[model samples]
Target: MTYQAKLIAGGKIVIPAELRKALGFQTGDSLVLEREGDSIVIKTYAQVVREVQKEFRTMVGEGYSVDQFLAERRADWGEE
Candidate 1:
């Protein structure tokens, strides 16, 4: 769906209700805005995390669990 959103006087744009419902956006939902050249992208925060994790695993070749990594890092920082 396409929408022509207006930039408010304070530079805030109100998302249209129909687009929000279609995208599963809620009042408190977080969104990320990314600009690449002349184009812009918006996606929910959850989607960004999932995409980041997928890319990280591909680059790092994960074997150890997240719990183990965090524990080790905390110990290095003298954190319990």
Candidate 2:
């Protein structure tokens, strides 16, 4: 769905109602914006967190505790 929106004053662009509904956005929701090769990508905070977790999961794998991993690293560094 392509919707053209105008850049309003104070650099605020109003997201269309239909687009907001499709994206499951609501009032007072936080959004993250990324600049990718001349394009802007908008995502919800939860979506960004999931993406980050996915990237980290490849290194940590499933059923691995990040806290435990960090503690081991700290032990190796003689910090704990």
Highest TM-score: which candidate? 2
What tens digits encode model 1's per-residue C-alpha lDDT throughout 37-71? 99988889998999999898887677757887899
What value of lDDT does candidate 1 attain over all alpha carbons?
A: 0.87
**Which digits, one per residue and each the tens of the lDDT, describe model 2 over residues 1-80?**
68988998999999999999999988888899999999999999999999999989898888789798999999999999
Task: Give stretches of model 1 more than 4 Å off.
Answer: 61-64, 68-80
Error of 1 at 51 (Å): 1.0
What are the candidates' C-alpha RMSDs? 3.1, 1.9
- Against the true structure, candidate 2 reaches a TM-score of 0.82
Residue-level lDDT for 57 in candidate 1: 86
Scored by CA lDDT, what does every candidate get?
0.87, 0.92
